[model samples]
Target: GKNALLLACMRGDLVEVQRLLQSDKADELFFVDSSSQNTVFHFACKEGHTEVVKELLRDNRCSPASAGLFRVTPFSIACEAGHVDTVKVLMDDNRVSVDC
Candidate 1:
């Protein structure tokens, strides 16, 4: 069920995501997808799941600045995808560098 957390983030299932985060497999949040090299935070931002994004941000393990393919950060991905709400949430996080 390692990938389940990623899928939950992709689907914006806040409840499932929350459950997974509390499980012993919570470390799954730090696993970058091998194919895309993107974190669960990236998927949440890309989908513009504002609540999901918020929940993920609550976890210190969730790296907001982690770059995926082509050096794309979750913030950059959100901006590129025109996910304004996601972008706003990232902006509010001190870990996310707006200057990037």
Candidate 2:
């Protein structure tokens, strides 16, 4: 399960993501990938996975602004990647800071 969640987010697998979220181990949602220090939110945001992003955001534990290996926030990545919808979803979250 090391990268299972990360992979699912990258592929935009909403169903698999939902199922994963229901598991007791769902807290792994914030597990940073070894290579990138990127969480599921990071991958989902960069790839423009709107549904996946929403699902990840539903969990209060997930942080939209979590930094990657070099301290790059998922919000910034989503903007750079042109994921308007994903960015919007993140922006709407009161937990995420647009200025950060």
Candidate 3:
């Protein structure tokens, strides 16, 4: 169930992501994929899904700076993946520290 959110983010499916976010299982926004320890936000950033990342960040509970395995934050993942727009989005968030 939560994996669906991660998958949606990975595929850059903004509509599906929005649908999932509005569902009762909104907590899935914070759910980290067990194998990767990456949250939906991380998946979105890594996939260069700027819209998906923006949608995820709209939720207050979605931590902009939450690190997954290897202490890799979404911002770092975005940069590593060459997601300039996603990086810009994350940089705009006050909770995301560039120093991290």
Number of the top-ranking candidate, with TM-score as the measure? 1
Per-residue CA lDDT of model 3 for 1-100, tens digit only, reads 5577888888999999889888888784568778778788888898999999998889877888888888988999989899898899888999898884
TM-score of each model, in listed order = 0.93, 0.89, 0.91
Judge candidate 2 against the unseen true structure and give its global Cα lDDT, from 0 to 1. Answer: 0.85
Alpha-carbon runs more than 4 Å astray in model 2: none
Q: TM-score for model 3?
A: 0.91
Q: Per-residue lDDT tens digits of candidate 1, residues 5-95?
A: 8888999999999999999978945699887888989989999999999999998888999989988899998998999988988999999
Order of candidates by TM-score, top first?
1, 3, 2
Report backbone clashes per prediction.
0, 0, 0
RMSD of each: 1.5, 1.7, 1.6
* Candidate 1 weakest lDDT stretch, 10 residues: 25-34
Full-model lDDT for every candidate: 0.89, 0.85, 0.85
- Residues 29-98 of candidate 2: C-alpha lDDT, one tens digit per residue: 5688788888888888889999999998888878886788888888999999998988888889888878
lDDT: which candidate is best? 1
Lowest summed lDDT across 10 adjacent residues in model 2 is found at 24-33
Candidate 1 collision pairs: none
